[model samples]
Target: MLPGLFRNASRMYDCTSRVLQHYEALYRLVGIPEKEMMHSIMKNSKFELFLMKVVQQKVVTGLIPLLNHISKSNIEVDLQEVFKRFTFDNSCLMVLGFDPISLSVEFPKRTYEKAFDEIEEAILYRHIVPKWCWKLQRWLQIGQEKKLRKAWDAFDRFLNQRIASKREQLLSREKTHLEEAKFDLLTAYMMQEEIVNMGVCSKSNKILRDTAFNLIAAGSDTMGAGLARFFWLIATHPSVEMKILKEIKENLMVKDDKKEVGVFRTAVKADTLPSGHHISANTPIIISLYAMGRMEEIWGEDCIQYKPERWISEQGGLISVPSYKFTAFGGGPRSCLGKAMAFIQMKIVATSIIWNFHFEMVEGHPVSPSVSVVLHMKHGLKVRITKRSV
Candidate 1:
C-alpha cells in the first residue's frame, strides 16, 4: 500500500524472489500445478490496483509506438506469429530487464531470441511428467532422452556462462567499491564469491536457470496470447474499437505541441546482431490487461465478449477499471515483479496492431488451447492481417 515509485518495490522484490524459489520446487512438489502461482498471485491478493497501473502504463507508453509502426509498414503477422515473439520479448525483459532485439522489425540474426526459445522448450519437457521419468529415459538412451540430456546440459552451460559473465562485468565496473552497494537480484546472486558447504546451492542453480526461464516462458506467452485475444476481440468488434479509439483521441491524444508518442525502436536495443532493446526500470510500461476485460458496462450484456466500449465511461470519459476485477499482473503478497516490465512489450505489440490491422483466420487455422505451463494456441494463431485505412 505504499505510494509512489519504489514504495513497495523492495517488498515486491522479496516476494518475487520467494515465488521464484518456490517455483524451483514446483516440479518436485505435487498438487501444485504449473503456472498455478501466477493465477494464485493475481486472483487472490491485495496489490491488484498496483499491478494494473504498471501494465497499463507499459502499453500506453513503451509498446504503442512499435506496434503502430509495424501496422503502418504493410507487414503481415498472424496471431501465432505475433504471440510467439510478443511473449518472448515480454518474458525476457521481466526476467533479466534485457530486451532481445528480434521483436524489432530491424532485427538481424536471432541468437538471443532463439536462446530463449530453447530454454522454454526445455522447461516444458521437464514439467509435463516427472524428473525421474526423464532420468529413467536417459539411462536407456531413449528417444527424447538424448535430446533432453543435451538440452539440460546446454541450458546449464548458458546460465553458468551468463552468471560468470555478469560477475566479471560487475567486478570490472565497480572497482571504486564506492558506488552504492545496491545491486539487482541477478548480480547479487551471481556474486556469491564464497563457495557453499554443500552442492545444494550449486545444484539449485539449474533450477534458478529453469525458473528464470519459466518467468519468460509462463508470463510472456500467456500474456501475449491474452493480449492477442483481446486485440482480436477488439478489432473484430468494431463498436469496441470505436469506443477505445475515442477514449484515446479524447483523453490520450496530443495536439501539435505535446510530443507525439515516441517510436519505441529505441526502447528496444537496435544493434548487437540478434538485437533487442534494453528495457529498464526507468521507463517501465503498465499492462492494464485486466481492465481490458472488467469493463462490463462498456461491453454490455457481455463485456466479457471482447467489447471495447466497456473501456469508455458511462459519460463518455475514459473510465477507470478496478485492478482486482481486471488484474493480469496479479496482486497481494507475490504479484509479478516484472509486471510493469512485461506490460511495455506486450502493449506495444498488441495496441499497435489492434489500431491499424484486422486479422482474418487462414482458410483452416485451428484455434485450440495447448494446455501446458502457459496457454498456447494448439495450432498456432494463423491469420492474414489487412491494414486499416488511416
Candidate 2:
C-alpha cells in the first residue's frame, strides 16, 4: 500500500477515496493530493539535510544522559523498548518541534504518547482482521474499533493543540516582526500554503498533522527495529560482532571511549514485470523484504548466513549489489529517502553500545519477529548489559 501510494502516477480509487471521506470529518483532514505534496517536500535535498542535522543532534543529546546509568548498571534492559522510546522522542522533536520528555528518568506518561501508541496498535490490528469485520465494528462503534475512535480523537487533540500553540507563536513573532527562524519539518509545511507552481498547499492544521504523522511513520520504529535486529544478530554471532566492531574501530575513525553518542550522519519506473505481467497503478502489492534478503536464488548459496565479509570485495572497494536484490532500505525512487540517515543513526547507536557495553542474551530467552507494520522482536530483546573496559 505504501509503495503503490508512493507511485509517481498513482491515483486513489473511488472506493478507497470514499473510505477516507467517511472518516475525514472525524479526524484531521488530508487527501491523496496532499499526500503527494508532502512526498515532494520530503524528497527535497535541502530539507532532507536539515532533517539529517536534526536527527544527529537529537541522537547525541538524547543518548549522552542515558549512558552513565546504562553503563553503570549490570542488569538486563529491554533494549527494544529503550530504542523505541528514544526514537519516539527524537521523532517527536523533529516532527513537532517540541520535546515530549518521554525519555526522562521516571519515563513519564503523556497523553500524546499514549495516543500515539493506541492509534498505531489499532491501525495494525485493523490490518490483521478482515476489512469488513473492522469496518462493521467501526460502524457499530464497538470493540477495537471503538477504542480506535477514541484513540483517533486523542491523537487529533494533540495535533490541534500543538498546531494552535505554534500558530500563536508565529503570530506573536509576526507582531514583533521577528525573522522566521522555525526549521522543523512541521513548521516548514505550515509556512507554505502552497508551492504555486507545484499546485499544492502544504498549509492547514490538518495538513500539518498529516505531514507530522507521515514523518513519524517513516522515521520511528523502522530504524529501531533494524537496530534491534542488528544488535541481536551480532550478539548471537561472535564472528559477525567482531567484524562489525573491527570495521567500526579501524575503518571509521570512532574512538572506543566516547561518552557522547558518536555522530554520524526510489520510484519504480515500470508497471510491467520481467515475465510480461502488468501491475496496475494503485494496486496494493506486498513485497516481503525479509523474504527477499534471504532468497537463495538472488543472494547465492550462503544467503542464509550472517556474513558481513560477503559485502567486501577482493579489491576491498566494497561490493555493490543491485538495489532490487538488497531491498532492505528498498529500491527505486520510492525507496527510503532516509537510507543514509538511517545508516548514520544506526552506526552511531550501534557503535556506542558495542564499545561501552557487553550484551548477553538472557538464557533461554525467546526471540522472534513480532507481527506488526515494523518487524520487532516478538517478546522483546532481553539482554544483560555489562560495561566494557575501553
Candidate 3:
C-alpha cells in the first residue's frame, strides 16, 4: 500500500491516480473496454483526413501570422510559449469545435488555460511533498489546494458553458443542416445515441463533461512540449540540425527558407525475456523507457548523441525500430491514438520554422527539465530568431 500522502492527494480533482476510474464511471463512451469511442474518433480513416485538415488550417491561420510578425520585426521569440499556445488552440478546435485564439500576438489570457495550468502544477506538487502536508493544507483549503479549488471551479464552469452552448446549437439546427457543421471529437461523443440510451439528461451531462475533459487534457500540452525539446536539442547540435534539415529537403523538398524547428503495455505471458533473462511466468515486469533509450548495450556506442543519421537506413528510407527499443509512441493496443496527428502537426510546424528562420539560444539561459508528467523546459527555452539568408 502507498503512503497517506499519495492517498490524500488522490482525493483532489486534479489527481490522476489509476485507481479513480472517473473516465469509466462518468461515461460508457469513454470507458468502454472495447474502445468504441476510439473506433469513431481514431480507428476510422475519416478521422485521419479530419486531422489533416485541422493541421493545415492551424498552420495557415495560427502559425503563419506568428511567423510573419517575427520576420518583419526580426526579434527574439520564446518558441516554447508559442508552441504551447499553438497546440492549445489546435487541440481546442479539434476537440471542442472552438478556437480560443490563444496564439495571437496579444496572448490574451483565458480562464480555462489558467485552470489547466494550475491543476497540472498542483498535481505535480502533490507527487513531490509529503502526503500529510498536502492533506492538511487541503483540509484547511489553504495554499496550493485553495488555488486548485479555484482552478477546478473555473475549469468546470468553462466546460459546462461550452457544453450548454454546443447542445443548444445542435438542437437549433435541422438534422440535415447539422451534417454540414464541422465535427469535433466532443460533438461525436455527444451525438452518440447509445450514450443517450444509457439514461436521463443528468447522466448524459456527466458523461459529456468527463469525456470532454479527458480528451481536452489528453490532447493538450504534451505534443508542444516535445516539439520544444526537439527544437532545443536540434538548435544546440548544429550537425544534427543540418542533417535533419537536409533529410527534410531530400524527402519533403523543404527549402533553406524554413528555419524550423522541431507507450504502454504489460504482460507476464513469457517466462523468459528475449535477452535470455528468466523470470517467473506471472511476475510483473515494468519497462523503463528512459533507461532503455540511453543504454549503450542496445543503442551502440553513440547512443548518447542526438544523431538523425541513426534513424536512416542504408536504403535512405526511415529505419523502423522494434517497438520495444523505441517506446516513444508506445506499442500494441494501448499505443498513442494521436501518433499520426502529432507527426503531421510537428512536421508542418517544424519544417516551416526551420526553413524560415534560425534560432539562437539566449546566452546563459539555462535549459533543464521540469518536474511533471511531460518533459518541459524548466525555465522555458528562451531564444532569438533571425530570418535565414538565402
Candidate 4:
C-alpha cells in the first residue's frame, strides 16, 4: 500500500541499479572510492565531535527540562514519545542540517512527526489485511489507505523542500570554503552529484528525496524504539541497571571510556538447503530474526532471558558475534549503513540519561510490542523520572 522508501523500486530490495545508487550517494558520500567511506564518515573526528556537541546541546536544552517538569509534576511520562521526539530532532539536524526542535520541553504536537507513525502503522495494516482488500482501499482512498496517502504526501513535501533549499544554498555559496565545512548527508549528496555527475538514477531529485527519507526514517524511529526497549529492560532488571550505572561511575572517575525486519529474500538460481531441504530457483524466503534470537540451538538454554552478559567476553570485552547470528542490524552485503552512527547516538543519549535520571516504571502499566512494521511499544512505556544525584 505504501511504497515510499522501503518498498520503492529503487530501495534496498533491488539488487542492481538501486544498490549502485546507494553506493554512489550513501557509501561514497565525498566522491571517494573507499569501500568503508560511510563508516569512516561516522568515525571521523570532526563528525564524532559534531555528534557529541549536538547530543550535549539536546540533553541540556531539551531533555533535562522535560524530565525536570515530569519530576516536578509527579506524572507518568511516556518515554517512547520522548525518545521519538529526541531522535527525530537529532536525525533532522544530522541529515538535513535543520533542527525542527520537536524535542522541546513543551512537547508540542508535530504533524510531520505524526505522519511517520501513521505511515508505519498503515504499512503494518497492509501486511495483515488481504492484498486485494488494501488494493481496493487504495483504489477508493478510504480508511488506513487514506492516512497513508496523506502521510506519503507529507513526506514528499518535507523532503522536497529541504532538498531544494540545500541545492539553492550550494549554488549561491562560494566553493572556496566548502571543503572545510561539515556537510550533512543532503549536502554531501548534492556535492557528490556535482563532482561525479551521477547516473540518471542518482541525477534525479527523486533519488535524493528517497535517500533522505529512508535515512531519516531508519535513523529516528528505529533508534527511538530501540532505546525505549533498552531502558525498559534495564528498569525491569535492577541488576543490569545497577551494573550499567556502576560502569558509568567507574568510567567517569577513571576519565576514560570506550564504548527488524519485515525481512524477506528471494532466490535467483536453484539451490539446495543446508538442512537437506531443496528449493527451486526464484523461491521467496522469510527470515524471522526474532525467532532466531530465541532458539536454544543458536543462543543456548537461557536465550529467552534478558542477559547483557551474553555479549560480554570472559575478559570483560565485547564478544564479536557474526552478523548472521545477531541479525538485528542485518547481515552480509546489505547490512545497515548507519550502524556506527546509530551506536554513537545511542551511547551519548543512553549515558546522559542513565547518569542524570532514574526511571521507575509505573506500576501495573502494560508493556508489549506494537503490531507494526517497527517494533514500538504497543501501549508506550510509562515511567516516573527522578533526578539522580551524581
Candidate 5:
C-alpha cells in the first residue's frame, strides 16, 4: 500500500508508470534526454547564473549575518539547525522564486518547516509499522497519521499560496516587461505546461505542486544533514581539516575546503538479478549506501576511517570512482538530479565558513546518528564558533 504522504500522485518518490513519462516530457523542454538532463542543467548557463546569484545572496544576507551573531555571542550553537535553515531558504528561492528568509540571527520558527519535519517522521513511521496499522490510523485520523495529514495540509497550503502568487507575478511581468533574467523551477514548469499544452492548467497545478514539494523536500534536509555530518567529521579529524585548509589556502589563494544513506526503488516488472536472486514485479529494494561506504572491498582497509586522501590522487586531482561503486548519490538512470547542484552549494558554504570561522565542539557533547529518513545527528551538532584571523 502507498503511504499517506504520497497518496496516488506521481511524485519524485512514486514509481507509477506515468511518472517516467511526465519526467521525460519535462526533460524534453530543457533540451536533453531524461538520463543526461541533470548534467546538462548543471552546465546550462541560465541555471548556473541563477544558482550563483541565489547562493551569493543567501551567503551575504542570511549565513554571514547569523554566523557573525553566533561568533560575537560566543555561545554554543547547533550547527545542524543553522545548516537546515540555510538550505531551506536556498531551496525555496531556487524552486519557488521566493525566499522565506528562514535563516537569520533571530532564529525564528517557521510553521511550514516544522510541518516538513512532522511529515518526514510520519513517513518513517509508516515504514516501521505494519501496513494495515498505519492505514487504519490514517482512516481513523489519529496518531502519526493524523499529524501527517495536518502536515500535508499545511504543506499544500504553503505551496498553493506560492503558486498563486507566482502566477500573478508572471502575468504582471508580462504586461510590465519587468521579467527576471532567470526562471525558477516552478516558473519553468508552469511555462512548460502553457507552451506544451500538457493538460488543463488547473489539473497541472497538482503536478506542479508535487514537483515543487519533491524538489524542496529532496534538496533541503538531505543537504543540511550531509553538511552537518561533514562539519562534525572535519571537526573531530583535525589533521584532515588542516589538510583541507592547506589545500584551500594554497590552491585558491584564500578561503578553506569541504547523502541519503540508502536508495529505495520499486521494481517495475519481474526480473532476475545478476547475482542470481529473483524478485517479483513491484518488489521494493533498499540499497544501503551507508553500508556500502564502509565496506573494505569498496573503499579499501581504511574505509571506516575519515580520510580526505582517499578521494585524492597522488597528482593532487580527484580520483574518479564509478557511480555503481560509490553509491552515495545512487547509481544508474535514477541517480540524483541535484548531485552537481549539491556539491556547488556545499563548496560555497564550506569554503566561506572554514575561511571565516573556526569551530570547536562543545565539551562532553555526544555526537551520534539519529534514526530517521535522513541521517541527522541524534543530538544536534553543538559547537562554538570563533572568527578566523584571516
Candidate 6:
C-alpha cells in the first residue's frame, strides 16, 4: 500500500523532491540538523513539509502539542500508552480531520484505547479464520463476526460523519480557506480530481477514504509496539540495561541524566567512547521486525540479548546504519515514516524510565503479540516500577 501510494508518483513530485534534496536527501539526513516533520504518508512526498504546511498545518500543529499534553497527564502509565494514543489520535486527525481526545484522562469515553484494541482483535481474526468463513460470519453477525461488525460500524460512523462534514465544507459557495483548515489527504483528494477536474476523487470517495484509513490504521501500532518492546527488553535484561545507561551517561551531564521522564536531546556526540566499544557498521535493520531481535548481525553472538551498545559505535553516533540491514521498520520504498519519531520518543521514554525507575516483571505474566497489522503486546505490559534516586 505504501509503495503503491508513493513510488509511481515520485517522478511527478520532482518539485518536492528537489526541495528535500536541497536539504540533503540522505533519507537518513545525517549530522545535519534541521526541523523534521514525521508523517506516515511520507512515502509519496505529497505530504512533505512544504505540502503539509500548506495542506495540514492545523492538524500537524495540533499533534505534538497534544502529545505534550498527554505526556504531562499519563505519568502513571507506560510511555507507549501515551505515545500510542497520541499518534493514533494524530493519525486520525491527519486523515479524518478531527480528534477523539483519547488521551484526555477525564473525558467521558471508554477511550480510543478499546477501539484500537478491538480493531486489532478483529484484524487478527481475519488472519486465523478462513476468509469465506469470516465473510459469511460477518454477513450473518455470528461469533467474532458480530464483534467485528460492531467495530466496523464504529469506524464507519466516525469516518462517514467526518467525510460528510468535509464534503459540506467543500461544497459551500465560499472559497476553501485551506490554509486555515487541516490539510489532509481527504482535502487533497477532493480538490485534485473532482468530477470536473480529473475524476480521481469523484469516481471513488470510498477508495480515497480507504487510502486515508490505510495510512491511519497501518501507522498507529508499529511505532508504539516497537518502543514498548524495546523498553521491555531493556527493563528485563540487566546487563543490556546497564549498557544503555552507561551510554546515556557518557553523553549526558549529571543534571541532564537526572532529569525526569522525557528529557530528550538531539542525537549528539559523546566527548569519547572507550576503545573496546565497537559496533557493527553500516548494517541495515533486519526486515522482519521479529527477525531483527533474533539476528546475529544485529546484536552479535548474543542475538537474543538486549544490548543497546550493539547500536552504539566506539566512535559514537549510530554505526553508519544502512537502510536495508535491519527490518526493524521494513525496508526500501515501504520504509516507515514513523521511524525517526519512534526512535526519538523511545530514547526519551526509555531514558526517563530507566533513569528514574527500577522495574521488575510480574512472575509468569503472559506477553504475546496482539495479532494486529503490527506486533503489539496482548494483555498489556505488566511490570512494577519503583522510583530510582540515582
- C-alpha lDDT of all candidate models, in order: 0.46, 0.62, 0.65, 0.69, 0.70, 0.50
lDDT of 5 by residue, 300-322 (tens): 88867766666666776677678
Choose the strongest candidate by TM-score. 5
**Reference-based TM-score, model 5:** 0.85
Candidate 1, residues 73-125: lDDT per residue as tens digits?
64545555555564565444434434454455453446455554454454455
Per-residue lDDT over 130-246 for candidate 6, one digit per residue giving the tens place of the 0 to 100 score: 789999988888888788677766776666677777777777723554543435656655655463365433525555445555556645555456556665665666776676576
Better of 2 and 5 by lDDT: 5
> Which of candidates 1 and 6 is the stronger one according to TM-score?
6
True lDDT of residue 294, candidate 4 = 74
Question: What is the C-alpha lDDT profile of model 3 across 121-171, one tens digit per residue?
Answer: 886677568889999989999999999899988988888887887787666
Candidate 2 achieves a global lDDT of 0.62
User: What's model 5's lDDT at 319?
Assistant: 70
**Which residue runs does candidate 3 get wrong by more than 4 Å?**
1-34, 130-133, 174-181, 194-203, 253-289
Q: Write the candidate numbers in order of decreasing lDDT.
A: 5, 4, 3, 2, 6, 1
What are the models' TM-scores?
0.56, 0.78, 0.80, 0.83, 0.85, 0.60
Which candidate gets the maximum lDDT versus the true structure? 5
CA lDDT, candidate 1, residue 59: 48
**Cα deviation of 109, candidate 4, in Å:** 2.0
Q: Who is ahead in lDDT, 3 or 5?
A: 5
Each model's RMSD to truth, in Å?
14.5, 7.8, 8.1, 7.6, 7.7, 13.7
Superposed by TM-score, candidate 6 places the C-alpha of residue 258 at a distance from the truth, in angstroms, of: 9.0
Question: Which residue pairs clash in candidate 4?
Answer: none
**Model 1 residue-pair collision total:** 24
